[model samples]
Target: MKGPALRGDLVTPSDARYERARVAYWAQFDEVRPSAVAYCETPADVAACLAFCQDAGIPAVPRSGGHSLGGYSTTDGLVVDVSRMSRVGVRRAGDGITAVVGAGARQVDSLAALWKEGVVVPGGMCPTVSAGGFVSGGGFGWLTRRYGMASDHVLAAQVVLADGRVVRCSESVEPDLFWALRGAGGGNFGVITEYEMRPRRVPTIVSFHLRWPWDAAQAVIAAWQRWIIDGPDDLGSAMSVTAVGGDPATVDVAGGWLGDPAALERHLDELVGDAGRRPEIRTVQEDSYLDTMMAAFGLTDTTAGQRQWTGQNPDAVIPRQHFAVDRSVLVDRPIPLTGIGEVLAAFEREPRPGQVRLLSFFALGGQVNRVPRTASAYVHRDAQFYLAFWVGLDRDLPDEGDRHAAQTWADDGFAVIDRYSGGEAYQNFIDPALGGWREAYYGENYSRLAEVKRTYDPHGFFRFAQSIG
Candidate 1:
């Protein structure tokens, strides 16, 4: 509080960096009325807490590891809490290595501290995410189809602007706020402590998971959209249709892979070829690199402090049993095979018995499709993959027919996924009543990320829900 109050006015909020300004992880909207939370630890302590919240006008929220989910990293006013400035370094940039990290480093301790020095980047997949809002929204897990997203391995960023000024951008200092802080999606651009990345050298082996059923959600999501339009960008995968336990008709199909492990058992044997005889599989096989990231966090009897950024703040509730529940946002493409046969008959009628859940897909293109959707500031270069879905409501059924059975399977899965995926969405898995969100999160660099949010937040001091101005 006082000590962290950037420059003077050693006031109160009981100081000591506002007692570690707690709360994060799925931060329940404004965490029960927040107002006096401020904690930053350098980059001039976020330019003296953005000059003491612009001379005490008060309205802040930067939080790291606070894994945002529409709650824009939680707010209600003043909250800097840069997750106690955790660091993660790695040198040798010339032809391949560089890493500054810190922005509350945590995606599995910065990927097992850069794979025990072998190096790597393109992070995300829980490991308690928060490399500053997962590189401000262009996140990618499972080594991003071979090292790419995660703002495509950054390059530079030390930010801290909005009247506080602590520059150090890159591609040339302040190159339009380093191209809208790579994929411009974190609260409007400003306080970004550190991130310099450029690492590589992973894949000692990267086996992952799979849990299918509900008649293989449209043949494992249309064979993973034809295995990502002709897979092999080092193979990352996805196929979800969730609602486990209180299932509204179960369906799961998870995936992930990198290399070795006999090429991940021959790529899960061509990804469950012909979708036959493939069920009940849970192998956390490893080849090192920190025991394959401790088997992607499924560590025997897992409990990494019950995740969601320790400060405890999770809430995605809606249980009261079966009825109407609508939510849709689709962007489909030619791979719609009659909407995967009506999502295999509305997931086998209305499944529940032993619910299935697998929803997380990464693996679009190598080098993230040679990036080019405006280099960074993520414009989904014409997308290769990024899918999301979470629908589970059934307590005893009767809340208006569970919101009409979750909006009739979310309007039949966003109208067969927008007739072949193209409606463009993924602004960090959106959910602000699903508006266009700056054309599906910075696609077309949303006007040069709103002119780099008019140079480091021209008064938009890190806004959200359509951030870059």
Candidate 2:
């Protein structure tokens, strides 16, 4: 039987737009040809698509920003894309500012909109990642240390259930569903249409970048870990060692600082003192909150309108990412110097020529840890840091052997970090190869999230490879 007519655009396989509409952020999923790509513009539009999927007995998957690392955003069935629904604004809420954002709003556009009102929310670094997936998986970024996860600021959300009902959930309205929506991960419950978030007011933001020699990777990792774990909450940072195109590996530490510029300089000096090596390159610039975020995203050369995923905007500057094998772990305690060395060595071993290999550590304590673990579905509260490793194959020469080599390297490097991890991983960076994902992603909160899943999506209509149920 034919489903109800949609209130939005639908690009079928026979349509001219299907080729562009079906692509995800990563090139790896480009081969996934969905039956149709529904550009949902409202809650009703989303409901219609879901109903159509159910009526036709075809699978449906939500795509916002299409940034799922595991490529869950695209499937062979139906792709319900919310990118066209994007809208963002800031308004006064009693004594605080509130951001009203469409679930499809990109992080860059949201940041720019809120900065105009002198307010901001914690969010992921990638500019094109949409709010729906990011917050649902517990978003974190440069402002996380000072403001906490993006989901922490959520005041309410509008969701379309599996049964075609549109409802708003918050602390007081559908509280159980609200709790699960915050961090149970996306695509498990229902489709999120909008998000109401509490925004933080900040005028000054200092962006800093420090690069050291490749040989200093271990020392820099150890010292940066200690610096962030001991530093004030005003600081947010991430350190990474990357080797692209078989070039010599390089170590870099970069992030934002909410405190005064002089204080941030002193903190950098302390980091250098601890690492016992002066960085070969250092840059510290104080800019407006929006500009600082733009710089962090490496969008300094592009205007706000151009900083988007390809095909989303004609003038978009960011290209789609290449095939990659990515994995992550949450560390409750800092890794000792020896462990850091071992991990660095693992990154350098059996290097795939022309493949991009990287290991990154994002500091996770401070305001994020101040909240109790059980306060929301995001259970990595006590973790001191979030560590991730990935191997990206060349976009032009993505050979079968390169993929195998990339996967092997990622698994070996991840194993090294897993020994020091707290058996927890970031739900946002979902890994298809991950074992015991339920426990690794949600920990003790899995049961609660499962219960909420049953209560809202009783028929299990909404599910993925590693859904809550």
Candidate 3:
């Protein structure tokens, strides 16, 4: 059979930009070489690429921000790149604010636009992560504790299915597809063209960071768990223990609160009182919600417009290129103090000379847990916190032994935490090493998601190693 004619720009191996286009955010997957990259500028272009790939019997994958940790966005056959279709704006629906975001729109672009309208949506902290996979896979961030996951705010979406069918789905239309799209909707169903999100009013936030020495790691973690268990919905926080290149470990708690500075101070005081000690350093600042986001992305030191929504210095962006491996688990309850010590011990293990290790705990619960388990495809609504074990290797490390050492360290750390984990994981993190990932990522929702997979993609055309069905 003859392949469908291409409508968008087809970048073959002979093209000058093919090499750069094939690279993902993580340097570890730089070896994946697609046969061709189709840059789609419209929904029709997406449908055309799907038709061509289906006719040619070629495996195809969609690429937006290209931040897939498992490299699911790149295939050996065809790649539909939607990074060129990025557009973000606010549309007025009656007296409400609706955010119109293209699938390729980056978090920085969307957040900056929404900030100008005095509204914000829950999104990942990374500036360049695309809304396509992030919202579909149930995104979370600083605002999650107060507002809920990013997927909860999605009002609708436009998708191009495997058979070249273009459709708009929401609660009122194609309800089953809408249910699956909320949480497990990575690239499993189709290529997302755009998203319609409901925005919430932005409030004056108190951003704070408290740091303690390596010796206080256990105490800080123990106190954090107790504090977040009963913390207010307006307070969102995360605790991180980081060790860089054989350096001593550093423990820090950082986050933003949606209320006044006084309320935030009292919360901090309670945390310190529980820990029975004072942090070595602490800083709190009351700023606009946009500035707090800017600080999280490491853009606070940049020029004025670059840190705010002034429509200037738009080109000042951060590039994330690192050889990293990360594994995560969701905990339904706080780990015992002894288990916390074991986790800290794993962090203390010496990595390679140029390797950095991080153990992070993202606070959950509050509004996040108010939703029922079966309310959406996301089954981890009962989880209290999300924990991640990450290790970064310097790209310049030439020794194969050093790379293996870094991997071993990361795996060992993950194993230590897995013992106390709630046996569930976040779909957005996408771990390739996980076994029985269907049950791990989606608990009771796995069977339903697989059924949805059959209904939409019976031929299993949109698939990766860990994709549904």
Which lDDT tens digits does candidate 2 get at residues 42-130?
A: 88999998888898889899998899888889888888899877889976758766889888999888888877777878878888899
Ranking by TM-score: 2, 3, 1
Q: lDDT for model 1, on a 0 to 1 scale? A: 0.62
Question: Which candidate has the highest lDDT of all?
Answer: 2
Model 2 reaches what TM-score against the true structure? 0.97
- How would you encode candidate 1's per-residue C-alpha lDDT over 112-142 as one tens digit per residue? 6777677767676677667887886788776
Q: Give the higher-TM-score candidate: 1 or 3.
A: 3
TM-score of 3: 0.95
RMSD per model, one decimal:
19.5, 1.5, 3.0
State residue 391's C-alpha deviation in candidate 3, in Å: 0.2
Q: Candidate 3, residues 12-95: lDDT per residue as tens digits?
A: 888887777677777677678888888889988999889888878898899988889888888888888887777888898688
- Scored by Cα lDDT, where does model 3 land? 0.85
Clashes of each: 34, 0, 0
Considering only N, C-alpha and C atoms within 3 Å, which residue pairs clash in candidate 2? none
Cα lDDT for residue 98, candidate 3:
90
